[model samples]
Target: MRYKRSTQERSLTSPARTTAPHVKKNVDRYGTTKLGKAAEKGDLEAVKQAYEQSPDELNQPDYAGIAPLQKASLKGHAGVVAYLIKQGCRPDVQDDQGDTPLIDAVTNGELDVVRILLKHGVNPHHSNSNGQRAMDFLE
Candidate 1:
């Protein structure tokens, strides 16, 4: 015989989910960098300044390996994502957990950002360390 679960029982039995370790480190690192700040704010000018002063910053990841593209994409900054891509940023660049900008945009429900990332040829089939794809995050 099988038993149906009560609402309280169901809630208690559900597994607790947490952000990956590197993702938290990425967040911490992002809040302290000019490029990460610019990307989070969608500030193209600041981004350009950072890039001009050090082109390598574009590809520079936080200690946790979150790049500017990932930061911009996570914040739903379509303009920043576009400009970064135009300036040679790789859309498919992944964080330590294998989460790409496309995954970030999709997870955030940023449709415009998703379109921009897709236009840049981000792989839709890519999965993160948890094995979740961009589509998995879609409503």
Candidate 2:
């Protein structure tokens, strides 16, 4: 369901880098440009480089509103997951479908990922599109 925008779309939506004197409003200055996929695949080096170039990329939501940290959790990428949390990514960020990282981790039976996210205070009670909580997925 993740679609890569065409060059024309990227150009059209790319925000103008404004100075302090001319702040733009209601624009996602930081765009999701394959970093979320890299994070989900647990490529720490790619994640590192992406963050180095645009640390704000960590906060950028995909069209589905899924954050990179959430993808990392769903894929059970522990190293990237840890690094993302240390970098201040919220473990409880919900996607447009209301699915948090904890929800994915639990449903995938990834106990370690669930533990790490819980340590970061991700709500186990957070429901997803199906109205199911993380605890509901626990065995």
Candidate 3:
């Protein structure tokens, strides 16, 4: 036999028992369009200002799926790249497709950029889902 009616089903209906859906912080939406584009244009001051104004600048990505560091490296902007590194932007942070800044440097045949990325802790062995690593992207 069942345990009979205990405290009734009302306990399960308590208003406080309801759960709310999780919502991400709105800050995540703020990508450094200014900073990333500045990196592309080799605008060091703009890149610096963008980073200073938005600490989350590291998370910003361009339309090409390139993060700030990736954009800087792609443009071969050593100054902007160095400044981003100082602000804690990682070179190996892959985009949606897992294309890291190192991959961009390698593919572009930017030797200095690749060396800088490697020095900043980008793993050369890391691969995307397509099985392409920074090494694969190398010229």
Predicted structure with the largest lDDT when compared to the true one: 1
User: What TM-score would candidate 3 get against the native?
Assistant: 0.71
Residue 23 alpha-carbon offset, candidate 2, angstroms: 15
Off by over 4 Å in 1: 1-32
Model 1, position 23, has a per-residue lDDT of 32
**Candidate number with the higher TM-score (1 or 2):** 1
As a whole number from 0 to 100, the lDDT of residue 134 in candidate 3 is: 78
TM-score, per-candidate, Cα-based: 0.76, 0.75, 0.71
Tens-digit lDDT string for candidate 3 (1-139): 6676433222122333221221111123333366676777889888778667656656555333567788778778877788888788876777768878787788888788887877888889988879898787644
Show pairs that collide, candidate 3.
Answer: none
* Maximum-TM-score candidate: 1
Return the lDDT, model 2, position 96: 77
Task: Report lDDT (Cα) of residue 78, candidate 2.
Answer: 84
> Which segments of model 2 are wrong by more than 4 Å?
1-32
Clashes of each: 0, 0, 0
The alpha-carbon RMSD values of the candidates against the true structure, listed in the order shown, are: 12.7, 8.9, 10.7
